[model samples]
Target: MTIIKNPVIPGMAPDPSIICVDERYYIATSTFHWTPGIQLFESKDLANWQLVGYALNNEEVNLRGTNTPAGIWAPHLSYDPQTKRFWLAYSHMVNMAGREFNADSYAIWATDIRGPWSEPIYFTSIGFDPALFHDEDGRHYLTILEWETREGYQAPGHIVLAEIDLPSGKLLSPWHRVTQGFTTRGCAEAPQIYKHQGAYFLLLASGGTGYAHGVEVGRAETIFGPYEAHPSGEPILTSSPRHLFSLGDPDAGHFEMVNPHSVMQKAGHGSLVHTHTDEWFMAHLMARPLEGQLLNPLGREASIQRMHWTEDNWLEMEDGSNLAKMTFKGLAGVPIDNEPNTDLFDSFQEPQYLLEFMTPYRQQHQSWVSTQKRQGFLRIYGGNSLFSQMNPAIMATRATSFTYEVETLLEFQPNHYSQTAGLGLYYDSNNWLYAHVTYSEEKRCPYLTLLQAKLGQRIEYVNTRVIVPEGNIQLKIGYDHGIANVYYRLEEQETWQILLQDLSVAYLSDEGVNGMPGEIGGFTGLFTFIGAVDAHQHQSYADFAYYKVTNHSPAS
Candidate 1:
């Protein structure tokens, strides 16, 4: 049997919705606050994944002012064999102020996986994390959480189901209240359904999204009502089964619940499928924190685990335990290559950027970022600063590893203090650490500076300033676990000089930078990218020769 690693898709690929169409496997994951929403990954053996495309690339919804952990929530993907169409259900979480979540859930269909998907058909605003299930008898059902806001009620919410008409986006029947949870581990959401044998199975994400996060299952003879909990009365799958502190707790970052022994945390929000060989597998969200740290700067990632049904018809891990494992015996005898989760390099030589690269809030503008401006360099015309959710000339890639280094060679001629360009780690507009080159009025020349944003507060490190010559400059950032160190050099062969060291930027993590208490810290993980700011009429341009990221051993 081949051994499949825990996290098949790393770096902020959370809330995975997996479907096996014919012999191919596809997963649609949540892209909170990132534009070109609903990232899709394709796999042949479920071991190696490729970013095929996204379901939402066009402007169906505006995300300009979307708050942290708010924009796009759980996205579900399914296929209706009767209609010969692919259906996608997702929520545009507009606001979560005061815990009254305001979300617009929608469904869209396309004949093929890579759309030309239809315009979003508004489904309901009842709650978020919507999923569509097509029964064998040509019936379409919707499952979602009925977010509870009552003072002494069930804390977070309950799983609810209803019959939905796809074409008109109308509900055919009243909602049926499903189980509050299969176990006492409350805070359930992201409900998905499946059928096996003669019973309908309801699967949910429970125990919150923290360390106690897990997947629980219940089965019913009918679509709704009278669903019986699993005989175990515990999560069918989890990373931390021994922790009992998360029961009935809706608060995020119960960092104390973190499982210190495992590299994977927050292992929940799962979707299941059967392979061609009749083997069972589930795709869920998992996080890989740096060693000895509970903060997950990479965010919740997509992980696959092998599963099986007992003789009594209840689902359990293939290894017969609820606790998640780092390595599982892969589909037996299925040979597959190990996929690397570490590094990348972009020389800006391509005519266009890859779909894996994404911008925040707004669509990419050619006037601001273009390859044609310079022959081999990516020319970025600075617009607004990184704090603006609107138009900022920043192109970013997912940071898959905690201990990695990202460096870029840039030639930026900033005419004003507002026109700066460089590279750094970004969680959102309100949270980031950027080391850049800007015009220093005091130095009377170009100088390198470091800027940081923690929970919407921006701080310019005046002591970190160093004047540099006006030519090609190489800037490097080292993220050794939680700490971020910034370095710069005149040339590739020159020794890197410290611009800033041990910045204690781990607070940029999902557990550390929550704008408000009690809610999730942040869903979108840390991203490494090159960005620029030009408040002065957007005239200045920075040409980046190349960008490189490499995984390295963390320093103590």
Candidate 2:
């Protein structure tokens, strides 16, 4: 028995799609509005995960200026042993603002996991959250969530299974809508099909994507027809411990949750996979707020839970409760240890961008970024302040927690007054902390200023002329939960000085002190950055000396 804690892969690691191939496990997750998208993580142990690479690095997958909850949606990974092929299914949830739920789904297949993955073969244009199942006899069938948009309907959602000739990527038969006003919660979607003991089981994420979120199950003698909901008739897994009015309704995917207890809201929509030794694990979403009091900036992070099966085939939490925690063991009982983990710190010894780096839209201009020059320095050319969700020069990584220190070395000599670069914490465009040195040409003097932007307001608390005889310096940011402080030093200064004080992260949080609406929810974490901004630049670049995360304080 091993005890892994809650949130196996912390901070906005949402829409987890896990697959086991030849003893190697791979997990793919959604990266909404953050470019260099679709991070892939690998693990030998089910409880520990490490980033392997990203699925989309082209500028086509926009992250800059992209809104919350709108980039990539649910991703599914499957392995077809016969062909030794890894097929990936995903959706680009474009234009979520008007609630234009119309999604563009696509499928990509790879022969080598390290991929030169085939260009996506567009799947159905009408839905999202798609999965594929390859049966024992070389038969391929597709399962996806078909939108139920008729207004007067009980729930505008249902799960459908269609047999498809994937080689041509077309449905072979009329899709079967296996769910309607029935057992389990109304928003029945994210369905996975599996066979055992001569029977097939259909697993679904019910209620909408919020408070009523739950994992539901059904079984049928056949893959397409006459399926019966699990006898329990309620969620097999849910977080309604105290049950509040907010946990009401229970939407289509979790549509039932009109209101819910704050304990664990938006807890469903997932895919389950069995370890080689037959242990069960599930990948689902959760959210954590910037302000302890409100779970805003609603980003969906992926959390894994353990499962045990009864002789009669009911799936349950290993200990019979869905309490969110970090540790769980594989059924085979391999040796386990709880080592403290870290996000990603780059010393740049490899002469390439670390896996932790991401751009706004993966803007294919390789000339824009590099790691080959200085062993630990990352060079990025500034281009745009922020563009549409489609593009921006900004680079960002996952926000691993509510509090953590992000420090980096920056060495840049600007050619013009417009080239100002440094490091700080960012929520979105409307709100962020900017701590950097701007060239003051009118005075031929450099100045260090702590500029804070709260939604509609921009406040500069510390604006002082700096004596930077040299061009290189170090920048550090300390976030005590949500309140923030900025620190920096000139070449002559021996120690870091606190440049700013008493800042509120809520301005950058879901509460929306800024122009943006706060995040909706799903336990996603925040992302930090160490880069340059060319808001108004004339061919100038910032060389990131190196960025590292340490237990040591940023101020020191």
Assess candidate 2 and give its lDDT. 0.65
Worst 10 residues of 2 by lDDT: 245-254
Per-residue CA lDDT of candidate 2, range 1-556, in tens? Answer: 6655556676667768888776667889877656656778887776667887767765444444455556677778888989889888888877654444777888888886667677778879767888888988898888887765566553445678988887678988988987643344565667888777778878787666655666777888888956787665666666543232222232322233423344345666667778887778877765554433544443556677888777887666778765443445554756545453754677666766667776544453556677765566777776554322443445566666555678877776665555667776666554566676667676575556656566536666544445454667788887766677777877777998877666667545434532233224222345576655565643667778678655332110
Count of clashing pairs, candidate 2 = 60
Q: Flag clash pairs in model 1.
A: none
**TM values, all candidates:** 0.95, 0.88
lDDT of 1: 0.84
What is residue 188's positional error in candidate 1, in angstroms? 1.1
Best by TM-score: 1
| Root-mean-square deviation of Cα positions for candidate 2 versus the true structure, in angstroms | 3.9
Candidate 1 residue spans exceeding 4 A from truth? 243-248, 442-444, 491-493, 515-520, 553-556
lDDT tens string, model 1, 466-546? 777674689999988788888999864469998888878887778778645544578789888897889988899999998
